[model samples]
Target chain A: MKKLINKPDDVIREQLEGMQAAHADLLKVNYEPFYITRAGGPVKGKVALVSGGGSGHEPMHGGFVGHGMLHAACPGEVFTSPTPDQMHEAAKAADGGAGVLNIVKNYTGDVMNFEMAAELAMADGIKVQNIVIDDDIAVKDSLYTAGRRGVGSTVLIEKICGAASEKGYDLEKLSALCRTLNQNGRSMGMALTSCITPGNGEPSFEIGDDEMEIGIGIHGEPGIKRDKIKSVDEITEMMTVSIIEDKPYTRKLKEWDFGKNEWVERELTDEPLKKGDKVIAFVNSMGGTPVSELYGVYRKMAQITDKFGLKIVRNLIGPYITSLEMQGCSITLMKVDDEMIKLWDAPVYTPGLKWGK
Target chain B: MLKKDHVLSWINRCYEVLEENRQYLTKLDTAIGDADHGNNMHRGFKKVHIQFETLQDKDIGAILKSVAMTLISSVGGASGPLYGTFFLQMGTKAGSKEELSPKEVAQIWRAGLEGVKMRGKAEPGDKTMVDVLTPVVESLERDVEAGKSLVEAIDQAVEAAEKGVQDTIPLIARKGRASYLGERSKGHQDPGATSSKLILQALRDSLS
Candidate 1:
């Protein structure tokens, strides 16, 4: 309950205002229906990419909004999905006549709101497509559950898809690439401490000092299993093995059918990782976990990947996505082709991610 | 007959009921889902209560539509769109009607239930609000067909809804955040179903 803030109600707005002030050159915030778009407006002829989810996962949908990344981000209340109107307005503001793509996480609220936004945007004569990301390996069954939660892989999809859009990929092509990125990536997370959402003013879950939660989503919900805390290497191995040994995941996903002019369900399966596959190994901190601890995770991660015969072609290590101040880290291993590797290397400038500008 | 005044009263009652149950609902959600359901519902209804000033003179349809818009924009979770769609569909069915017969009430609620089903894609056993809503809609339709009074039909619907909520306690969740826990999602009553029961109870209270 102890943290820096005025009132719980003002947390999202105040943080957004601070973000606007600090990153004025990179992005602009619209408060009424709340969304963040690139500072200079839409990039003409490029398919605009928009993503959003709950607020506590900072530097995610918001921080990734800038050149060669997300064109806009709609932030919701802490651990809550943004309304459809926010996404509708953002699509209208960010559309450059090349259509808009909504990158939605696999959460129920996030998916439903984005679907409504797509419907609204389409009625307004704007072409819209939604690609849902469900890369978390934690959820074991898709048939009986709500499916896997989207986690660390979302950051990678945004970066690669952003680059593809910058290269003049059409809306349909960008959607396809985004789907491919989701299929090729898998992530698993564990938490040492639970996050305290500002609205609740209490930890989302109580974990004993000696215990940890594995298979956690970004929203601070309790994960699939809680176990006693283990060494960095052992924990890293546990998570990495879950990802590497995960079976091919199949699930029904909703997609906008431009020709049919309606939403349709499509069954998609993610191929399992195998030997000699090239990957971009991402070691991401949940929030309170320091980079030093993440490196400790990456060291073990690198050894494990090597031992498993998976080649680490490139890597990203930091807190790009977070759950308030939860102390944990997630590992994302994304299979990359030459095109994907090249796109990952492309120039990107944003408040949360900047390089090769 | 169900009048516009009754609809308004039901909405106002919902605000008070949700306020009283906020902490209780949050505790339920904390067990199987993220602990925000109570706060999310309370915030949405609080905004809807404010719109009463503007909705006072409107017909039942208009009032319900306004409430839907408020909840959709303010609620900010799976419940937001689900509940928003419920009200919106009711509004659509009740369009331009200041009062409705008991049969008409049944039809409107049926429409709302279908809208929720379409929006959330949840079946009756999914351990969602749909579980509570479906039985209530069925009870209302059956009671109205049997020539029951508005109060009698609603009373039966409330009973059906209560039973539906209880039924969720032993079932595994197959939708929303609770589904993420798999078997662990069992044992707790669903937060969505619980809120849905409160909504139906408010309707019955308003009629009385």
Candidate 2:
């Protein structure tokens, strides 16, 4: 309940205003139906990338809105999905005459809102396609549940796909590349503490001092199971093993069929990881977990990947995607091809993630 | 007969009722799902309440359509689209109508219920708003078929919704965030169902 904020109602708006002030050179913020887009406006003749979700996960969709990353991000209330109007407006703002690609995470609210937005945008004569990411391995049944929550892999998709767009990839090609990345990535997380949303003014879930929840999503929702607190190595091993050894996930996902101009359900499957596959490993914090401790988790992750003969050709460690002050970390392993590696190494500049020019 | 004023009264009653039960619904959600159902519902209806200024002279269909757009734009969770679609379908069914007979009201409820089902894809026992809505719609339809008055039919529908809320306490969740908990989701009342009951109660109170 105790946090630094003027009021619960103004939290999102004030934060966005502060972000606009701090990063004016990089992005522009639109209020009313809130969304953030690149400062100089949409890149001409390039496929624009747009993504969004609930607000608590900071430095994600918003912070990634800059050069070589997301072109626009629609932020909703904390832990709530953004409405269709925001996305529709953002797509209109970011479309560069090539088309627009919506990088949606696979949550019920997020998917439904984005689907509605896609419909709205298409009706406006804008070419739009949606690629949903469901890379978390924690949820066991897609048929019975909302399916695995999209976690760290979203960061990777935005970065790599952003680079692809910069390289003149068209809307259809960008959508296909996004699907490939989603199929190859898996993530798992563990939380030592719960997060308090500003509006609720309470911890999302209560946890015992001596316990931790495993298989957690970015939101402070309770994970698959709770267990006694273990050492960093043990926790890392559990999460890494789950990601590396996860079975191929098959689920029915809705995609817009341009031919019919409607949403259609298609069954898609993510292939599992195996030995000799090269990967870009990402270790992320859930807001409150410090980078120094993430190194401890990463140290163990590096050793485990070596033992499994999975080559970690690239690695990103930090709070690239995070929940609001929740003490936890998640690890994502995305199998990479030569093209993906080239994209990963491409020059990029954003507030949350910046390197290589 | 359900008149335009009655529909407006129902919406205003929903805003007040949801605000009053906000914490209680959030508490219910804390047990089995993320603890935001109350806040989400209140937020959506609060926006709907503001639109009442512009809605006073509109037809029932136009009023409900405005409410749907407000909720869909302002409310940013699973509840937003589910409830938004409910109102949208109701508005579509009641198009250009300033008043409705008992059967028309029943048909509107049926359309709203089916819209919720299609949007959330939850069955009757999935411990969602659909659980409460299904029985409410069925009760209204049955009562209307039996030549009941508007007040009488709505009263029976509210009772059915109340029972539906209680019925969810023992069932396992198979949809939404609560389903993530598996069997742990049992024993707690579904927050969505509870709020749905309030929606029906608001209608009954409006008619009375």
TM-score of chain A of each: 0.99, 0.99
Q: After superposition, how far is residue A38 of candidate 2 from its true place, in Å?
A: 0.6
Error of 1 at A105 (Å): 0.5
* Total colliding residue pairs, candidate 2: 0
Q: What TM-score does candidate 1 reach?
A: 0.99
Q: Write the per-residue lDDT of candidate 2 for residues A1-357, one digit (tens) a residue.
A: 889999999999999999999999999999978999999998999999999999988899899999999999999999999999999999999999999999999888888889889988988998999999998888999877788888899999999999999999999899999999999999998899998989888888889999999998787655778999999999999999888889878888888888887778889888888899999999999989999999999999999999999999999999888889999999999999999999999988988989899
Q: What DockQ values do the models have? A: 0.79, 0.73
Highest lDDT: which candidate? 1
lDDT tens readout by residue for model 1, A1-43:
8989999999999999999999999999999999999999999
**lDDT per residue as tens, model 2, B1-208:** 9999999999999999999999999999878777788999999999888877999989999999899999899888788888899999999999999999999999999999999988888999888999999999999999999999999999888889989999999988888888877788889999999998999899888987
How far in Å is the alpha carbon of A75 misplaced in model 1? 0.5
TM-score for all models, in order of appearance = 0.99, 0.99
lDDT of 2: 0.91
Model 1, B1-208: lDDT tens per residue? 9998999999999999999999999999988899999999999999998877999999999999999999999898898899999999999999999999999999999999999999999999999999999999999999999999999989988889989999999999999999988788889999999999999889888988
